[model samples]
Target: MSKLLKFSAETGEKFLTYSLVSVGLGTVIAQVAPHVWFLDNYAGLFQLYKKGFAVEVPSHFETMLSEISDDLAIPVKNPLTRLLTVIGFDTMHFGTTSTTSGCFIGIPVNFNYKSEKDIDKLSIQVGNKSVPWDSKDGIELANSLILSDAAKRFGIAYELSLVDTFKFYLHCFSGPVIVIICGGVNNYFCNIFGLPYRPFPVKGVFYGLLIAFGIGFYYLSKDLITTYYEMQALKNVSKVGEEYITGGLEFYDKLLARNKALRNLLPDGSSEFNTDGDSIYLFRKKHVPITVKKQLLEKELEKLNHSNII
Candidate 1:
């Protein structure tokens, strides 16, 4: 009822919706009328932010990013480390000695050539430790996060909308075709303000307001859309993080189990590391990096605990 209708964090308030409507209306007018400057501005804006976000980085990124990177093994030399170097994350390489890696769009991720051996060669450094990856999950998680970040940075899903390509088809190509054929026929019948009835400098005041509004829309949209997606992405990452942790623990279990079987059967003094010592694999790479979603992991673990307790 009122709660649903109320302007709140959940809804990005009414202003965002209103701004979207206004912006959408303005864009439509720019297309139909195809007023040169208006259309040009719309097209330019779309081209600029076509990838669902503007090019700016977020401010509070370090805090949340730290939460993500905490104990998340990165290569001693990794692109991710390079990307976050300004914020005190300075590492090198996302791959092994023969492995090649690079960053794209500011995301510290390795290039995926779709080769298993190449990917498996990738390892990240956590403190003095090296954690290796075998699966594509880390890269996948990075892609979602990168896109979400772009959206958050730019303030719209224009990057997600893939609308710039559509604009090329609908406006850049078709708009001209329609304008040309219509112009030719109109010349014979009517003279609409000599040629090309420009709207700017006439309705510039109104058009200027819409452009101004669009700027605000960009900011708010980033705030709203990013707020929502960040939550969901974090939830997914948390689940993956849990799996990554569990796998590591299980890998340790395997080593312990094997050693236990060997130790008990070996009678008096027939062991390599030590007769009574706990077998700890120091050099062996156990699990890949785990990127956690802070709050989501708590909630997830809570649910599991509740079920077990019941």
Candidate 2:
């Protein structure tokens, strides 16, 4: 029985060690070569290319890129920040350009949907929440969501600002950090209370409690970090110019409007989204509330207007 207890302790230690090592390796891969796992569809690496979704990069998008780069003094040039058009509802940036390998930003095809056929294509794509409407209504809905040039620029700048930060790297390390801290705490408790030599039931409960605590801590910490950086990015991008300031406000307003439309259109509208159009999460949220985003930008716009008058 003594020999079995010793073996059990050793086995548990080995398992923890292996888990930590694997997570550390995964963190490294995610930071350096994220494309290995993420955006496979965007890269067309697996399965047949999604039809009618992959469109050529728009000419004006290039102009927006150049303008934003010049205004923000960020190097999001070709090869460093590759842009791809894919079928989706949102325009988003992936990975970071800080790595030698570069990163990608995806422009959703739905943003440019104009025709009846385009609306049909959008209806079938995944992640779409809109209820089926007539072709005329669909075109109107799509057009309503279509952002103006200034709003689009602000959106792109916001995305660029996020990728250009250490948020991604911090996100990668968050898991490992939580593991190391939790592991240390676990060890400390086990040694202090003689947990290892305790009966199986006691050990099981103790370890289970630690695992639960670790998961909670990890999410709370990550969400707080995400919220902080998201706000910081908003503030940073708002400083670019007055148009960007107004543009940022318009961007959030339009998004909220879109969400409101979706909430009415989706089957589970009231349950899935709040009246304000933000998705209602079960536990916690990683992104700032759209209402809050609009409020911040509105304040900035008011300040700019007052200053102009002065």
Candidate 3:
């Protein structure tokens, strides 16, 4: 039994330690490692991008989206590319050398894109360093940031419309989903939500949110596991508790019987004991009362089989 308890304690401690360490590591990585953040939350970013590009707009993004859509809506490149890409951005090169900078909300952005293997591995480079066109990790990271940033600016540049509102919702959603695609969620949402228009670093928000989420999840799960174990342990000891209660009742009944037998011998069958506080005292004819405390009775019963009470 001692060995079993030792093992259970060790296991519980280890589980708690592991959970804490994992959450702490995840938070540290999310904060210091931008690439990891991007990879973890890319799914949410993709969803936001889809919402951003679909809204009707008159900005440069709209023009780009339109041309890209036309080329993609009916794929002339391949039967597979019909609904997605007009020309694969993988091979497409853009530079600020009079060929790549595009106007975004009147802001000229150095948007350049390249892909390797296929569209799934497309990379976008802004200025001299975005991500290499061939680096899959770099490309994925860029794709998340670029698409999110572009869509947000496009929403801002265009008139008040469904797109802007959607962008706000996207920002709210993005605040917590920082683990995926390092950066980019809802720039529009962030601006409006923060109001008064202060500059909010998206990456900083991402890291903080990631850390908060990791810690929250770890503690929540640990508490749940601990509760479950406590319940199970109680269930295992239920029989012992029951035995203790039964033993106590039997001891009381025997004591009462013994007292009654003693009194019956007195001809009048009178009681000879009285309860006083936590003690029981016996009355002796022409002598001082002898006393036995309730605790002593319980202790005597307990000594008979210590395990049951335990």
Q: Tens-digit lDDT track for model 3 on 1-310?
A: 3686556545644664465455445555643243222422331222212323522223445455444334223221221111111121111111111111211111112122222232332232233334344455343333432323333322222211111122222322332343232212223334456411323365356446745665454444444443343333222222233343233333333334434333433333353433321113242122111122224334544654686457
lDDT at 123 for candidate 2?
44
lDDT of 1 at 141: 24
TM-score, every prediction: 0.25, 0.86, 0.18
Please give the ranking of all candidate structures by TM-score, highest first, separated by commas: 2, 1, 3
Model 3, residue 181: C-alpha shift (Å): 14
lDDT tens digits, residue span 89-193, model 1: 111111111113222123222221123333333343322334223224333322222222322222111111122123222332332333343334434422444
* lDDT score of residue 126 within candidate 2: 19
Could you say which candidate leads in lDDT? 2
Candidate 1 residue runs with Cα over 4 Å from true position? 1-84, 88-202, 241-297
lDDT of 2 by residue, 1-310 (tens): 5898899887887887788678656756755454524644435432213554446777878788878888888897643776677544666776676775566667665545444455554445213554455544344455556676788788888888777788777777787888888779878977898767788899889878887887788788778888888898888888887999888887787777767766666667677779987878889887889899888888888887898899
Q: lDDT for every model?
A: 0.33, 0.72, 0.32
